[model samples]
Structures are given as C-alpha cells and as structure tokens.
Target: MYSYDVKVLPKNTSLWGGVGIEKAISSNSLLICRNDELGVSLKLFTKNQDDGAVPFGTLAPGETYIFRLNEVTLIGAKTTDDVSDSMVRCTIVCPQSN
Candidate 1:
C-alpha cells in the first residue's frame, strides 16, 4: 500500500466500502475493514453497488484524502488494491519501497 499521511486513528467501526478515484496518480482496490476491539474483518455492502465503488469522501478528483494501509491486493510494479472502480486506466503498481 502507498504511504499516505493520515490524521484519523483506526477506530473499531463498520466500514462503508466504495470505489477509488480514477483520475488519481495512483489507484488501487480499496477494502473497508471493521475491528470492534476484537479481530479484524472487512466490511462490504450487501448489494452489488458497493462491491467496488469508492466512498464519496475518498480520493476525489483534485481532492486528496489521507488514508491508512487498509490492505494491499496486488504486487508487482508498485502496490495497490487492484481496485476496478478507479477512474484512470493504468497498470497495477507493485510495492517496492518496503
């Protein structure tokens, strides 16, 4: 996962999954995880609309929202979640720094 500066702590709460910003320099499949002071489990929408669409507050075009390393899905060139909802169409980024 890309190292993005964050301001919020990982609180134990349900996640409302959504797609990624397509016009971003970097894009990846984003998964919302839930941890209620117990083990961690990813939260997904019951319907198909939320399957990949990023939340409304995520990486909006021209707007950058800081996010934590929720998780990484693909690795090779750079590193990203392999998200399909991203607006930009580019190759996958594999993690190389660490």
Candidate 2:
C-alpha cells in the first residue's frame, strides 16, 4: 500500500474510491465524510436522516479515519475553520497496482 494527499480546501472536494487505491483519512481538524448511497459499511450517517448522510464524527486535530471498501465509492468533505486556505488533508492508501 502507498499514501497520497487528498486535500479539502475552503470549498468542497470529492474523494472517490477505486480498486487500485484504498482511502484512509487522518485529519488535523473536523472533517466531514458524506456518502449519497445507503447500506455501505464505511459510510457515516445520522439517525434523523434516512438518506444515510453523516459526518466522520469530528476528526480531532490529530485523528485518522480508515475506510474499507471492495468497490468504488464517492464521498465529500471540507474543513470547519473555513480559512482562506483551510484544508483537510487525507493520506490515501493505494495498492501497488495504482
């Protein structure tokens, strides 16, 4: 496995999973993880929403969220600070084939 950067700037950004690359995120601040699809094991969701939308549960200043997937998946997030260059940097673990 290998690691790379996926940044969530002041605006929004989408992270898509694939067979070649596996994503595992460790953020320096609060980072959101949203999935549009339902019943995916790695997805986070809230009790009030039936659409299976949820946060990655407040990834503190130094926390990592590991995702396990066998198929392609899509998700998005942004930093809470909203600074000019506010970024939520995630290190994506990619397989050798990637």
Candidate 3:
C-alpha cells in the first residue's frame, strides 16, 4: 500500500458584481466551480494585460464547470440576469505533492 498527502494550494474565493478575484491564478491552474446562479457570466484572460478578456461562457445554479485553465492569468465573473448584483462562488485549486 502506498500513501501520500495532497496539499491544496491557496484559499477558495468568490466574485460578485462584475468584480475580479483579488488573487490572480497562475497559468494552467485548476478552477473549480462551486456555486453559480442567476446566469453568471464568466471571463478569463491572460497575464499579458493587452490580451484582453476571453469569454469562458456562463453557468447556472447547481451546475459546475471544471477545467485546467490555459495560460490564464485572471478571472472575472458577474451575473447576466435582469437583476442587479449577482454572486458566484468558485474554488481555485493547485495540486502539490507532500
């Protein structure tokens, strides 16, 4: 039997009202969608700044989107529904060996 410890890097965060997460993710990091509702719009961009933002599509309630971002630097999200100020919760995970 082989046993190993997996370390989860960084803390989970949430974005609301078209705001960006305070912490930027390094390229090829893992992004896990925790909770999303009210038609949240997701955007991902590179660290180059001038690269602009890339639309990563939207997610609904009880739905999850998980992916290993490609050269992703920052991530921003907001609600696309008729109502004002929506919230989306996401967990950023980077696997590290013990």
Best by TM-score: 3
Candidate 3's displacement at residue 52, Å, is 0.5
Deviation of model 3 at 44, angstroms:
7.1
What's the candidate order when arranged by decreasing lDDT? 3, 2, 1
Residue by residue across 1-98, what tens digits does model 3's lDDT show? Answer: 11222111122222311234334444545666543354344332223234555566655554766656454445545444434343444565666768
Candidate lDDT scores, in order, read: 0.24, 0.38, 0.43
Residue lDDT tens for model 2, 1-98: 33344555444445444223344333322223332221112212221112333465444333445554332243444444555322334444443333
**Superposing all C-alpha atoms, what RMSD in Å does each candidate have to the true structure?**
14.9, 11.8, 9.4
How does each model score on TM-score? 0.18, 0.43, 0.49
Least well predicted 10-residue stretch by lDDT in candidate 3: 1-10
How many Å off is the CA of 24 in candidate 3? Answer: 8.0
**Candidate 1 TM-score, true structure as reference:** 0.18
Question: Runs in model 3 with CA error above 4 Å?
Answer: 1-28, 37-50, 96-98
Report the lDDT tens digits of candidate 1 across residue range 1-98. 32222112222111222233222223334432212222222222221222333333223222222233234221111112332222211222244455
Clash counts per candidate, in order, are 17, 0, 0
Candidate 3: C-alpha lDDT: 0.43
